[model samples]
Target: MFLAVGLGNPGTRFERTRHNAGFRVVDILAERLGVPWKSEDRFSWARGVVGDKTLYLLKPLTFMNLSGEGLLAFFAHHGCAFEELIVIHDELDFPPGVVRIKIGGGVAGHRGLQSIVEALGREDFVRVRVGIGKPERRELVVDHVLGVPEKEESIILEAAEKRAAEAVLCIVEWGVQRAMNVFNAREENGQKEAC
Candidate 1:
């Protein structure tokens, strides 16, 4: 079974934050797949499935800094191979409307991803980098990412997520490269194709 994990802090407070993009995608996955995502405190996870794939939908209660603990335990408990794992998280490097799906790249100062790499004991797993873009000013970086997108911007963000969900399907069914090619396409002036 393929293991799909979305990275985000768990709680009502984080529900609408841009930094919680991963969690939002997880919700999308749950709805699209009709997965009964039960709250599993034992695994520190929300467990479910999509298609024939067994999905371990997770929101780390350990907060963003220590996400590895939950991820490692989940893998160990399920006996899931490293190849079966895929993580979806946000990236500050790309514009808000884009998503980058690649295999084994640097974490680029993302502590959450850094923690995952450290705990996974490998650097080759696939990552779906959903871009929220860079902040206008360095001082506002945290607030910008963690804060909710304004109503107008929310349209673009939701479009990004819908595309992301499809990309996740392609990644799981085909492979990362195929998904990358299919999902990474843009219009002449640079906008994602319709979902």
Candidate 2:
């Protein structure tokens, strides 16, 4: 079994914010798979299959800071290993709409990532990063992430969310190495890389 976790704050207030990029990606995946989410005490989940593999899509309701709590509960019940876990979240380093795949790394101060690392006691899980770009002033970081993007940026981000969902599917179908090759290379070439 493979588990994919999308990090974001729950509720309509945060629905379109840049910080909710992960949730957007997972939402797309769920729609594509025609799976309906079932809400748990701490999170919501949808189950589907891809090429004979069962994949669980999770969205924590504990919000961004306490995301790990919901994840820990999921682990306790469903029992998944660190290696089989994939986390999707926003990235401030890359330009808006850029998507990247990574295997284990620091949280880069992302509260959601930090929470997961703390709960899991490891940082080696797979990550699908959806870039939201950074704020001009360091002090504006919070406002930037939690704020909704401009019309043009929203269009870009919407596309990125779809691509991030595709990247997750690719990783499940062909493994992380192949997914990284396809996605990361695409990033460099400024063109879609065939999987």
Tell me how candidate 1 scores on lDDT: 0.73
Candidate 2 structure quality by residue, lDDT tens digits, 15-118: 99999999989899999999999998999999998888888999999999999999988877777653478999999999998999999999999999999999
Candidate 1's displacement at residue 29, Å, is 0.7
Lowest lDDT 10-residue stretch of candidate 1: 186-195
TM-score for each prediction? 0.87, 0.97
Top TM-score hit: 2
Candidate 1 — which residues are off by over 4 angstroms?
42-53, 187-195
- Could you tell me the lDDT of residue 104 within candidate 1? 90
Tens-place lDDT digits, model 1, residues 29-82: 778877666554423454555555565566555667677877766766666653
Q: How many collisions per candidate?
A: 0, 0
**In order, what lDDT does every prediction score?**
0.73, 0.93
Candidate 2 residue 64 Cα shift, in angstroms, is 0.1
